[model samples]
Target: MCHDWGESGDGAVVVLEGEVGWLSCSLFSHPSVYNYTSALSTGLNLFWYRLPAGHDLEQPIGYSQRLSKERERLWLQPATAEDTGQYICMLSNKSSCTKISMRLEVLARDQVVRGCEPAVAVAPSQVIAPLQEGMTLDCPDLQDVVKMADSSPSVTWYHRCQKFPTWGSDREQRGLSLQIHVMLTTYDGSYYCTVHYQRRGRELQYSRSINVTAVYPSSLPKHPSILQPTQDHIFKVEQGCTQVRLECRGHFPYLAGDWDIWWTVDGKKVEELNNSRFFQNNRQVKYDYGDRTVESVLLIQNLQAKDLNREYNCSVRNQRGFDTHRAHLEQEVPLPSVELGCGLGVTLLLMLVLFVVYHVFWLELLLLYRSWFGTDERHTDDKEFDVYISYARNSEEEQFVLTTLRRVLENELGYSVCIFDRDSLPGGTITDETLTFVARSRRLLVVVSPGYASQGSQALLELKAGIDGMARGGHLRVILVQYRPVRRQGWVRELRRARVALALVRWQGDKSRELTSRFWKRLRVELPVRRVSGVEGGGGGGEEGGSEGEVALRRLHSQNSTSSQTGLITNTVKEPQKVISIAAYL
Candidate 1:
């Protein structure tokens, strides 16, 4: 017996060695409704591949006398313990491609091995959930197997082969499902469940393995909240612009299909308003750590007087609750017309002055504004360091970080920075201390150089810790500083990935040494905003402040003369003539 044809799942099969084991594609399974035979008649092509994939990759299964395909079902005449990894069955054609993978655990009867006899199942044995949260595990696709037997489903759980982890709780059986009060990283491994039943006056078992990944809790599912088109946000519209667009964006975690973001105008949905000009379009983007961003755009074409008075709302909702942000269009205030006397010359001069002010003093103005208005990350969490510098010790990069980057970021900029050599406490394991530092820091500033990775394992450990923390959606964010050009192969895979995904700043010889240079500006933008007790305004104070920031840069510029190639690191990891721009996030 099989499951419904519409159901698509990946399951595990446990078979004893030397026994004739049957493997079926669980992409669409059915006993009599629709099976592989029916799929082939409908012009679908099926291919099988053994998993743990070969050197050539997901290659199709080769011909063998012991293995034969009868009515599109894979038959292992004498299953061996060597064939105990995963297997993928691909159902495809010219237009579409679908694949289902199954773990085949072939038990050897010759040895006293812990084993279970698994029957047919139709669901995937993979589970992913947030760490520290209570999670429940179920034996998916076991319904048919249990129903066929004349007994209740009493499941036994196994972790990492057959060894179970420390439960630290009451081992209460909750039907066929198991529950954990708090998910931990220690439980991050494969788990198998076996359920015994009576069939034909004989005992039988059904087993499956579920690979569990416990990610950081930041990506945990929650009620939808708006990211943009803030509450009662008003967008200014000009008299000549034909249309106005209002966009609302929100981030959701897992099960994005169950959530929605939409627009409503004047207490009615966009479709219910019955206005073609008020139509809306929605899009959902999946991010890493199982987070999704949903955006709803409300386009108002041929804007009219009534449209200005009407209220527009962008609402987002999940199973828990919903969040709505109201938006309104208001007429942009026009500048007062001036007589062609001295007013015109004064206006031009004023505009020039404003441009110079903004172009030259942008960083100062931004820092001042952030100090006053921006939400300080300090209050939100109890992180000790604002920045943690990861670099190769006893090298030019370390000198640059300790003497230049560290000094400026700590002394000039009011930020608590943690550098391993300078700040690490006495006597702690390298892995534990480095990982802890990465966790407690708000940002990791990786000074990438040729010597960093090759110098020792400690540098690589720090780099990996930072990347892992960021990937987990933990408190630490990463910022890559290309101190000097490194050969493509010299870079670690994770570091290369981090460079591609996170913000990257390059040192451009003496040019980037200036505080006013683009390199420092970009690097400063990624750093946590320093809280200023009082505003540092006035021409004198600003100049003094700028000069102070320039002091260490100038000192470093005079000290080290780098004779390295200034080039961009492309996806091919090849050295190119162009420089890589620092992107906060793509």
Candidate 2:
């Protein structure tokens, strides 16, 4: 009845009376990447017991054991016949405990159970197991009798070797057919199916060991191989050409699996087959260097003076690993061969003669607007204008207005006028002298348009500068050409402070009218009467007393005829034309 318990090459086994217990070399303890630990709900509990010598019924003594709850391990000293019958190791957190028991039946060699498959291999089909699901694997046939818990096909699942849970139908419950509702990591390896059945009134048990190698992707490539030199290399042929080859390898579990490889040159991927430069045992870089011949071979061929001292890299890869190697060649080239001649010089001269850009800068070639341009150097006696044209982005439109005004002033009235535009500046510098022009001018004509207002931050900044100039008592003129009529509410609030309003020209309506020309004629008539000059009105080019809002509304009214007017009445309400004026609703 007394028996010894131990581990051997084939796994746990039982020895009957008068039998020599054989231990396989595999059980001697070797390095194993497959080693894992199991967890129980509570501390580990080890139960050791044996039958008395000469009596199968007497309780055996002298069995002592110790277990570590923190380490989850149990150790027994001097295992003997009276020391082992059934040794049960159980883990429990006090709340719950899972138990696994091994029986040691000592007997003669002739009493051995024949044809029991002690070896089993379980391969998981997936990386993660969802709760309440069963995974399938090829079950090893053992002892001509395979029983999951000595019954039909349902076996309770275990973490290490402790029962987790068991449930299944008769059809869905055999061999590897037990299901446990447990959300588990891929590393949760302890699992097995046990067939439980009765035989001859004695309790019989058959269990298959479940070794779950939780399938998951590796954290890193097995072999991180990289090419040394870049594929695109600037090389001096006098030294040597760069020669590159693909070097590939991987590590860990990937070595036990299949993989592929590939390569990229410069920025483009080089297919393995098309290039004659690559030579191998029919193994192209396209195969990912998996084969023996292509694993570490250089793809660049014919290292010559032309390719000398160049850089190139060879890349190798697979599903779980990658590697690269860069190379350099040392073939020297004669520098004396490179030269230039008189024929080439003559061709260059002819091209220079034909191409204008070769002789002139782009600015000198721009369209000349002679009358609308000015110099940074202004004469001390330069006559000041009643208005300064201040525009941010609409240089073209400003130039057109400048041309018209210049003709109106000089040709028609024989007055000297100066205008500044981007084209007017010889070197495109908006210098202090430009600001001086703005300061000297009696009035500033700011052409407001949506496009000009939104050109950039600089355009807005320029508008701000113009406003600052106006605040210093210099006249500020605003010419709001109805450019698509997009309402700018914020700008209107700011413009309310200045004694100025837009010249409202009637848009294309059913009513026939010439509002722009009439406004110009009105401006001509008002110019002599309202001109502000001298110190009290000095630099304040606009008339000292007029409501800007009234002017704006009056201009708006002038554009409409009584017949086409909306059903709204207009009345004149006397109020200060302050910059921040809120007009009365009329």
Candidate 3:
């Protein structure tokens, strides 16, 4: 006799023949139902009955007649040949009703001996083993049972009597092994393997079970971490220093041989306790929380200038990953000295002040020096004419030379002016007259113009005489007055030679009063000091003073009324020509 079980509408059923079995009539409740009275009210009620062979209706049976004293189990006595019939179990509640029936055919003992026995036997084995969390668990091999079958069998795996769905289909027979790839503590239980086979037009099933226990390791280490030098991680070292010390630390779980720590300068690696300029010392520490920390001290000895601005890397590595911290060793910058800065500021200020003064009052300063040291009684007695004027042969230029310049020098400025056309004796040798006048004059004023450059002969004669007088070391000074713009291309050799020796004053038109004042002042500075002679003004004096000279000049001017009136004189020895009247004043 075979027994089977199935679930009905709010209950479960169990059918058996000629054997003892328990029937649970309580309906399975959903986990969400919290009230006990509500669950009990909806539970299944049990009923039992019997059906005679070939009968369609069931005969009601009482629990006291066929059930054991427990009333939850039904017991059938031995010698079941008289009990060949159908047994039915019914279960009902307010929400559902269900029943199950099983037929029993009781044959004689000799007839049961003639039937075939079961061809499959489930193996019995027990396993008590400890597995890690990540390890795999395999079921017992079924190759022997599979070999006995004609074809490959179907296999199902269960954990704790429930279906195991981690592996893709539980029914697998090709390999005859079930695997739990990654085991956990929840997987620690009895695992069942059921094999199904077909033999002689009959289906056969067998089962095997094993127990597993999962165990965890004592400690698991994470990746190492560096935890020292919290603020910016920058190291300052002076150039040419003796040594620099740096510290690096890391934290990790207390697992031996799982972490490595070191240091690197730039990109090259440095080791601990090495025989080099850069070396380190390492130590390991443990905490109560099972964490191991490692620290390394780097010693860079005999630091040089080249070590400045270099990066030092501290790296830690373990099974998980690595970490690096960088520190820079730089030279310290020094502040500037106050004394040096003050000295530089003073020097610049003085230079600027001197430049302004020189730009504003240079002429006044020169005049002051000349007034202090320029006059000498010994040289004043030897000088004759105060100034000699030279110009081109053109009548207009001659008139200007005789009238404008001569009037300013002799009349207004009290200087005796000499010109070749006026001061020289008519019919005299020109070269001799030129040299004589240039020698007698204290200053040779050459009035230069485009017309003057064309009169090569007269300009050269005057320039050469003046240059020779200057070379002779007399009180002869040459001054160039640029009356008009003149090109140097037509300049005579003598004029070119005197260019560097002579001082030039350009004549802007008299429209600007400031310019005219500046012009007169510059020209007067070049002239010699005025000397008073007893013969010229009835004053007898070997030493000249400023007051005496002014009086003598005023008296001499009163005597030369004709020359002062006309500012010119006609050459009396030959054809009439305009000339500067210098002899009357001299």
Candidate number with greatest TM-score? 3
* lDDT (Cα atoms) of all candidates against the true structure: 0.68, 0.38, 0.59
Candidate 2 TM-score over all chains jointly:
0.26
Q: What does candidate 1's lDDT look like per residue over 38-99, in tens digits?
A: 77877777788875635535566775755666555676656777878777777677776667
Name the top lDDT candidate: 1
lDDT for predicted candidate 3 compared with the true structure? 0.59
TM-score of each: 0.33, 0.26, 0.35
User: Which lDDT tens digits does candidate 2 get at residues 1-586?
Assistant: 2122242323354433321122112211333511114222224333333334465442323422211111222222112344345444333344554334444544343443333322122222323332234454333333323321234433444444334332223113234444333333533454544434442343443435555543323343455343333444333333344453444322222334554444444434456447666543224333221222234343567544443444455555555565555545544555543355566777798888758673453323221221234321223335354444444434454444444543343233222233443212232224443555666654444445555544232334435555776566545433343323445553543444442544433222222123234333433332222221221242222223434554344234323323221211111112123111211110
Clashes of each: 0, 57, 1
Candidate ordering by lDDT (highest first): 1, 3, 2
Off by over 4 Å in 1: 1-123, 126-130, 133-181, 185-223, 251-257, 285-293, 334-586
Which regions of candidate 2 are displaced past 4 Å?
Answer: 1-155, 158-171, 175-190, 195-208, 212-586
Worst 10 residues of 2 by lDDT: 566-575
RMSD of 1: 34.2
